[model samples]
Target: MGKVTGFLEHQRVKETYQPAEARLRHYQEFVSTLPVLDARTQAARCMDCGIPFCNNGCPVNNIIPDFNDLVYRDDWKSAIDVLHSTNNFPEFTGRICPAPCEAACTLNFNNEPVGIKSIERSIIDRAWEEGWVVPQPPAVNTGRRVAVIGSGPAGLAAAQQLARAGHDVTVFEKNDRVGGLLRYGIPDFKLEKTSIDRRVRQMEQEGVTFRTGVLVGDWPVGSRVGNLSTETVSPERLRTEFDAVLLAGGAEQPRDLPVPGRELDGVHFAMEFLPQQNRVNAGDRLERQIHAAGKHVIVIGGGDTGSDCMGTSHRHGAASVTQFELLPQPPEQEHKPLSWPYWPQKLRTSSSHEEGGAREFAIGTKEFIGENGRVTGIRTVRLAWEGGRMTEVEGSEQVLPADLVLLAMGFVSPVGSVLEAFGVARDPRGNAQASTEEEGGYVTNVPGVFAAGDMRRGQSLVVWAIREGRQAARAVDEFLMGQSALPR
Candidate 1:
């Protein structure tokens, strides 16, 4: 512990967000990392608890306390090393992750938790500025080639690790651009594209090759999943060439609302609306786009995707925006006694929520109302929950006016085209069936084929994706060389 009484002496400080009015004018990151002095002060607040739960709380198991102590002692170089030992991309997690680690901090049992995310962001930023981040190519090539599908965080992490372990690595991206979901699914307002580009550059120097505009298997025709492939590669080709193949593609099949007027012109999936703006921001000239400008927008499913829709609608100068959630609202404050050192269900207000929007809870969309082959409004009903079962409240049905509707419900599973092409078995939830056991883990039914990230475990966080990617790299390395020194 840097300061034994630090928790009692200091207060938790958060990263600063640009004013909502100014931030809404453009599609760029609005949050500013904490200053070095404030970051050190925040780091001093880590407790000398017997066990550090923040490590287990994080999906990648980041060394939270060690880095916290390093930042407090002004040893930034050591902090970055500790951070990179476990996590490959601190920048991504620092900017977008919900930071479950903070929720599990010992100080959070009573006092505000240390600003671990902000400190993490500061450490990496300083490392990049000082040019400490560099490529570490393998000393000797093993002549073993590994093919990675998808250029998202998981694929990138696995590719980088395999390259460092002396395997010839190549990543195939279906879209015209790399970064997968980070390039298209997430908006630039939360994370600028340059953040991903620099990391890609570093990975390239580490001997990992990226081939964009290439699809590995068939994509469902007219599917809402983003696709900009200029070429398609058969699964047989990869098996014949590469020693191992890792499926790291995302779970992109967005959950749909199959109501009466679902086919209306103005209704669309959240992926359909979010990706266009990202492409436009990247300077691509789209012939047509799903714009929210000058329209009344209704976003169904009150999760992160719904919040993103609301934010983008604000940027588009929509007339009004409303969000709906089927479940009841969670309490603003969590009960520490019951949820200590664990992720608790509570209301989380994002930066977009601060900009503007109406949030409706315990409400379900019954039908889509439209005229002239376009959406005009939505029919909704309030509900009550008893004994964990929901019952619709009588006489509480109403219509909410809208010009556009976006289904922002979470993803159900990975798009199955690639799995089908490779003849891989799927779990009950439609994700690739692969265990996480110590032996023969991350391997599919097909020899030399492995699965990880959302493709294997279904939709999850970026940190989880990185963890799976790293572990899968180790699994592939062992399969290729009979053993590996890479961390699992």
Candidate 2:
């Protein structure tokens, strides 16, 4: 610990952000960094908890207390080294992760966590500014070849780890550019593409080869990854060319609302809308862009993806924006005493919601009302939960004007064709079947084939994806070389 009584002497402070009105005008990151002195002061707030629940709370098991002490002691370089010892990308997690570690902080018993996420962001940002971040290429080659499919966090993480382990790693992405969802799914204001570009460059320096615009399955794909490519590489080729193959493809099947008027022109998936804006922000020419200008928009789903759509719509100057959630609204604050260590269920009003958008909960969309093949409005009904089931309330049906409707209900599973193409069995939930046990974890049904990340575990957070990828890389290395040094 930096100081025995530091926690008692300091109070928690977080990073600041630009005014909502100003930030909504452009798709650039607006969060300002905490000053060095203030960051050290905040770092001092970390209590010397004997158990350190933050480690268990974090999916990547970041060394929270050690790094906090390092920051408090002004050991900036060592602090970042400690941060990267576990997490492959602190910048990505710092900006986007919900920071479950903070929730698990012992100080959270009183509802004021140690501000772990902010501290993390400060350390990594400082490292980059000071040029402490650099690539570490392996000294010797293992002569083993590995192919990682998907190019998302999981795939990227696995490829980087394997390459560092002295294996030849190649990542295949269906998109035209690298970074997978980091490149296209997330909006620019939250995490700029530069962060991803920097990491990709570092990975390349570490000897990982990235191949974009290469689909790993059949033609006429229905998902976004499929739409990015004109041709697909058969699984047979992958199996023959690479010593081991890891399927890190994300869950691309979007959950759809198959109500009437689903085929209307103005109705689109959140994926369809989110990626176009990202491409435009990257200076790509979109002949026909999806915009919410002068139109009333309704986004069905209240998750991060939905909020992203809300933010993007505001940037497009939508006439009005409304978001609906089928589940009832959670409490404004979590019951902290009862949920100190677990992820709490509470009202999470994102920055996008603050920008300008009406949000409704416990409402079910009934039908899409359209005119001349375009969506015009949405009919909905109020719902109540009873006996753990949601039932619509009588005499509570309503209609809202909507020019564009986005379905952000989350993903169902990976595309079946890709899984089938590899002849890999899937779990009951339709994900690639892979265990996490020492004996068979991450190994798929087919020999020399593995799976990880959202493709194997279903939709999850970026931190979890990184963990899966790192672990999967170890598994692949072990399979190919009969031994491995990569961390699990």
Candidate 3:
């Protein structure tokens, strides 16, 4: 809108990255933000499309066109204002979000879309550098006390919103640090913990209390693998003390590969392996921390988590890295006509994939080969789909060397104990049962109890989690005060 023919004049400019070899030496953010003029040019590329699909494409419904125009007009302050108006944390999404908004951009019908993600990163980074980002404490106290379970993006967003509504908000986290997966599960190469710390400080100034390393329910039994809770607080205590409780614990129960030799050592869940390295990077000393140094590593599941593992393994000086996907490899590109205005299925090669690794698709693992109680390799078989059934290809069985096997098959559900303690119902897919309706939305079966984010909707993007948290804050506010002014 700032320039009538800006899209035609400028091609999309992407952020530059540090050489993979140089970045692999340490765990730090490697992607460089766009220059100011470049960001402005990208923002200028936002055409005056009558219908702004980018807004709806974004899970948080960010005012994309407004921010783009503001940035293009050299009004960085207003750009950040419009940005923070919707997204509680743009830095996280700007760095990691797949940018479905760009996919839905009208210009993307034929030409390259506006570099929205790069511009977003530039605006927020500038805001922080210029001291434009600061605490916005509420004007008055509402005298309501709210408890938010978990300190991931979802919980943090809800806490900030609820606190701004003049409520006494407290967040509970099972990890030693405030951020849940952001501080542990994710590699520092994408998002540094310092970014999370800055927001945590702002939230504290806004009257939000954080209780870390405290489990809000019974400790998950039988699996000490991923449990980070050191202290326990009974669900009854929270129910009796707080006016309302919001369950925002993320889906943490990782799906497992239960083939033969799964019990062997060195075959670990992605959660277990990832958190260990993250802790190490944070300067925590752990004896026998998992490492990929000089070992043939096989990462199962070709998702973001698997990519993260691949990157981490590369940092660990892995001998060789290989990834596996059960499904057939997707096409290199999508047909725009059929998939316009929505996320498309195509071959996605992450920065980690670009670093170095072998990717095997349409292959299934038959068994794990081990020696002396340790995994040594994996037996695989090629597959073909016929009539909705997978048929093994004859004479296609093979064994691959694997000193370490990381299962990054995504999470199945939240730790059941926490939900069971609150007596929250679960959906067929095992996510916390709740709705997003305006009336009694996010409310669980139990009175004064609500759920949001990954807990309520299952594992999803950080943007979606932030959206759920903000909306659920409004729902909780309405439940306690009978009405709320917070945005959905």
Q: Give the TM-score of candidate 2.
A: 0.97
Error of 2 at 436 (Å): 0.3
* For every candidate, C-alpha RMSD to the true structure in Å: 1.6, 1.6, 1.6
Judge candidate 1 at residue 167 and give its lDDT. 96
Report the C-alpha lDDT of model 3 over 308-359, residue by residue, as the tens digit.
9999999999999999998889999888889888988899999999999899
Question: Compared with the true structure, what per-residue lDDT tens digits does model 1 show for residues 1-488?
Answer: 55779998999888888999999999999999889999999999998987999999999999999999999999999999999999999999998898999999999999899889999999999999999999888999999999999999999999999999999999999887889889998999988999999999999998999998787876444333244526778899999999999999999989999988899999999999999999999999888799999999999988888999999999999999999999999999999989988999999898889999899999988899999999999999999988999999999999999899999999999988899999999999999998997495999999999999999999899999999999999999999999999998
Name the lDDT of candidate 2.
Answer: 0.91
Q: How accurate locally is residue 293 in candidate 3, as Cα lDDT from 0 to 100?
A: 98
Residue 408 alpha-carbon offset, candidate 2, angstroms: 0.5
TM-score each candidate.
Answer: 0.98, 0.97, 0.98
TM-score of 1: 0.98
- Candidate 3: Cα lDDT at 65: 93
lDDT (Cα, tens digit) per residue for candidate 2, span 1-488:
55667778777788898998899889999998788888888888888779999999999999999999999999999999999989899999999999999989988888478888888999999999999999999999999899999888999889999999999988988889988888889999999999999999999999999888877876555445534534568899989999999999888899999998899999999999999999999988888888999999999999999999999999999999999999999999999989889899999988899999899999999999988889999999999998889899999998889999999999999989889988999999999999997584799889999999999999999999999999999899889888888887
